[model samples]
Target: MFRDTSHLVVEELSRTLERIDPAQVQAFVDALLAADKVFVVGVGRVLLALQAMTKRFAHLGIAITYVGAITEPAITPKDLLVVGSGSGSSLFPLAIARKAKAIGAKVVHIGSNPQSDMKDVADFMVRIPVRTKLYLDDEIDSRQPMTSLFEQSLLIFGDIVAKMIIDERQLDLKGLWQHHANLE
Candidate 1:
């Protein structure tokens, strides 16, 4: 049962990711590379995914932080705020996105529902188009429970963008090791 379930989950992830527009991913990468700093916000599992992305971006020498961290710096016009919420209406992320926009910072929303309130706040969106709690018509159906597929896809998408950044900058792979947490 474990093996069968694993295969099914992988298959679902593949389908969900395949539907995402490559152009959207490229735009997100461009924004990340252009930003002086990147701030991420989300809740629950989505926040965990963004945190992973934050660490990976740090490894690439990009200035990144998860919102609400004790050391989080003030966002400026040149910085970017990345909000991850499968439904795009998670209260905390939505509020943070709005605040970031008010501060003149660019906001990029990564979620399944493009039509959610986040649409008005985000400067742009890199949609995952997976099954969210809202069950929007265009979202890809998932057999997994709740928003698992979306969270899993978001995690993988972050890694994909990190790899794209590495390739675009032609960074030395060996040098990235220096950025990994030494205490861990």
Candidate 2:
């Protein structure tokens, strides 16, 4: 079972890389650069990815907010909401995406499913091809167990986006490093 699970994970990961569109990523990076503010949110393991983005992005020229211990609020025309949801159909994420749109903010969704509820709301959607929770049996923490590809991918994808943002913005290492915390 362990070996099968390992193979499944690798296969899904390879498919995910293959399916990712560089153009879509560029557009997402462009949007982030243009926005006055950026907000990233996710649930469960996906949130770990968002937290990483929040840290790195805060160093950039733009303002980056995240949903962690508290659900941070960001709703404005110049605001961009970035959501990482492997399911694409989760209520909280979709609802927040809707609210962001209601306030004229642009929405970006990173998920395994392209046809998810949030897809319709997203101005930019980066699809990562991975199995949905339905493929796995119930486990204590998984949303569903045996299917954590999205969670894992979110971590990787967020870093990928961050690099894209850096390049698109033409930010040098020193510029970003300046945003680093002196106290820490």
User: In TM-score terms, which candidate is top?
Assistant: 1
Q: Give the Cα error of residue 3 in candidate 2, in Å.
A: 12
Across 1-184, the per-residue lDDT of candidate 2 in tens digits comes to 8898788767766666666788887888888888888888787678877788788878776788874446565468988999888778878888888988999999999876776688789987987666676443321122225547667766777677778777767779776778888996
TM-score of 1: 0.98
Positional deviation of residue 106's Cα in model 2 after best superposition, in angstroms? 0.7
lDDT of 1: 0.95
Lowest-lDDT window of 10 residues in candidate 2?
A: 135-144
Kindly report which residue stretches of model 1 are placed more than 4 angstroms away from their true locations once superposed: none
Using all chains and alpha carbons, the TM-scores for the candidates as numbered come to 0.98, 0.80
Candidate 1 per-residue C-alpha lDDT over 1-114 given as tens digits, one digit per residue, 9 for 90 to 100:
999999999999999889999999999999998999999999999999999999999999999999999999999999999999989999999999999999999999999998
Clashes of each: 0, 0
